[model samples]
Target: MLLELFTGKCPIDECFSGDVNLPKWVQSAFPENFMQVIDSKLLVGDVCNEDHDDGDGDDDDNLYVSPEIQVEYCLATVIEIGLSCTRDSPDGRITIRHALQKLKNAKHNFLKNRNGEKM
Candidate 1:
């Protein structure tokens, strides 16, 4: 469930760890910290059943995050990451599609590792 928009991989182990000790560019560019801020407001019972370990709630578990929130978070992260890259690169720009593809690759690798599937 970790969502990020970095051109490179995340350095921390946890999705919401929000370790700010990394480079400033990463801190500003990734959505990890931003997501942490949003998640911190969740009361004990506010989050979806699946997000919690208890998982006994009757509500459907299909949608842990609403589509609107997902879109906003994703876009913010992409913009920040793109800005950082453009700042460093001579081209001074990035495409939304490419940024999203990087996120997809990171998620695929993470899921494969978690599932204990060998490469």
Candidate 2:
């Protein structure tokens, strides 16, 4: 649920081929080509309404996050967590407590960076 919120796409909808699973598809693009896998809609800053344009020329503030380094770090952290949760071996999977801790740390780091705090 959280993964979908962050990624903005259903894995089943994006990677539903017989030969590939969502995790594999995502893993293939990680570290080197991670940006290619992110949702483009999340990068848009402002959206214009075609039908309700009153010629006022005001930009509509849509929900968007910049692809800055800090944002990328946060995204990478979440992706790593997802990968950990989806591991083939049960022994390799992380516990819910550990996952939540990781997420909290990632959020903290992201917020710290966003607030101009040194690491």
Candidate 3:
């Protein structure tokens, strides 16, 4: 689910190579070109853009949340979680509890930054 959010590609539909999976593909490109792996829509801040017509045939009201540093941090956190969860060895993988905690922390930080609260 997190991987889908970042890459905007369904793993079952897009990643089919026997030698590599979605997580591996993301991991390989993350170190250098992380933005390239992210969904273009996300990079363009399209998720929050809503088109609403205000009676007068004027579609001037558009709501958008521009991508910021917090977005990058959140993406990085989720990518780390995805990588941890997809480890080849079960022992190397993080438990659900740990993953949840990490997610919560990321969410907290994102919200904090969004609110302009000091960390």
* TM per candidate: 0.30, 0.72, 0.72
TM-score, prediction 1: 0.30
What are the per-residue Cα lDDT tens digits for candidate 3 across 1-119? 67778888777755558877778788888756676788888777423423334345544334223335568778888888988888889999999999999999999878875554434
What residue pairs clash in candidate 2, if any at all?
none
Candidate 1: Cα lDDT at 92: 61
RMSD of 1: 12.7
Per-residue lDDT of candidate 2, residues 58-104 (tens digit): 56422223336667778888888987887789999998899999999
* Candidates by lDDT, descending order: 3, 2, 1
Clashing pairs in 3: none
Residues 1-119, candidate 1, lDDT per residue (tens digit)? Answer: 12223223353534335544233434464565544333322323422322422265655444345433443455455445544444445566456566668767655654553343333
Please list the residue runs of candidate 3 whose C-alpha ends up more than 4 Å from where it truly belongs after superposition: 14-18, 46-67
